[model samples]
Target: MTTARGDSPADETGGLTRVLVADDQALVRAGFVALLDAQDDIEVVGEADNGEEAVRLTRQLIPDVVLMDIRMPILDGLGATRTIAGEPGLAGVRVVILTTFELDEYVFEALRSGATGFLVKHTEPADLLRAIRVVAAGDALLSPGVTRRLVAQFASHAKQPASGADLAELTDRERDVMTLVAEGLTNAEIAGRLYLSPATARTHVSRILLKLGARDRTQLVVIAYESGLVRPGWQ
Candidate 1:
């Protein structure tokens, strides 16, 4: 469902964003590869046709980002993401789930399983590129509206029970930042809303992540909801 558009010269390896794409459909995979390969800052390092192979290639390639489809043979994207996230050596690698629909049922589970975020298969080429760049730069792809809906819909059924003990670990300021983060505010936006400098806001987020032992901001969002620190339909 990816749309290929304009071409650009390749970037040198020194600063290139290495990526691996895993999808069952050949055409879809090809489209993603073509579009990414044309970007000056990105490079497609490997391709996998199944979840098992996706895990293998991801370990071998050590890609900065993995674009993984939710369904595949031998395993699923959620399983592979869990495997990758649990690996100590691959901690820096970010996984972005690819779904056929924006609100795919497994999207919330995928985020819980350690995905940085997700994108619909039909996402625009430029947006997809920006998502890759964002994830590669250590930011999650969560949009407030979609993420709130998707997580709220499925988080009530989450395997992990609600635990306010997690919230007890944060300072009041960190808690405020976490709430805004669950609302899908970026560091800059959070800074604006809280009347703090962007750097200070980022520090608060970092401290929250450390205190909660969250993998990243995406996981923090999950914690915020499932722990009842933030509730559904609350502005």
Candidate 2:
């Protein structure tokens, strides 16, 4: 069931970021809602006890971000993510996986399933706030070294790279930017390393995402490894 967070979906017309929290644990969900609701720039519009309701509320509320639990009844997080991703109407909605286990195998799958970020339940409140903003602003929450390690670990076992997953579609500079992205470097860091302007680096990333038909930077990282554009521990 979906619980309206007191604020109707229409209340999100302001600049405040609308967020939906989905978790099976009542206390945890309340904690997240309380923390997020306290933020001036954020608003918790709805809450769900499972992934199915999460997707339902997502479609109904059209929130900017969804904090989804990986383990849920009816539909798991990954399944929910895939469904949301498959819907063209939900393109603006970014799902961030919330897990107690940082390296859960499904975390990588969640990314491939169209989740743009992953966060452990123990993440600091400040970091959690930053993550929602970042993901909402069109960047992925894959900056954590654990994210890189997790992607690399599963990429090794990933089935043969998808057909046409090669980097031939990318220009030389785009390839460089993709490598830095796979290394967990942000736009600023990539610009610093590549000696390009931050805006230019961001442009390159956007182009990469478009040309490769990737959902976001997280998929670009997965492609870099799975397509052999980058290898594990190659730095």
C-alpha TM-score for every candidate: 0.91, 0.92
Q: Please give, for residues 25-141, the per-residue lDDT of candidate 1 as tens digits.
A: 999999999999999888888888888888887777788899999998888898999899889888899999999887776888888878888899999898899889998999744
Candidate 1 yields a Cα-based lDDT of: 0.84
Tens digits of per-residue lDDT for model 2, 81-148? 98998798888888899999887789888887788879999999998999999988886444558888
The regions of model 2 sitting more than 4 angstroms off are: 5-12, 160-164
Error of 2 at 9 (Å): 5.5
Give RMSD (Å) of candidate 1 vs. truth.
4.7
- Please give the lDDT score for candidate 2: 0.86
Top model by TM-score, which number?
2
RMSD of each: 4.7, 2.0
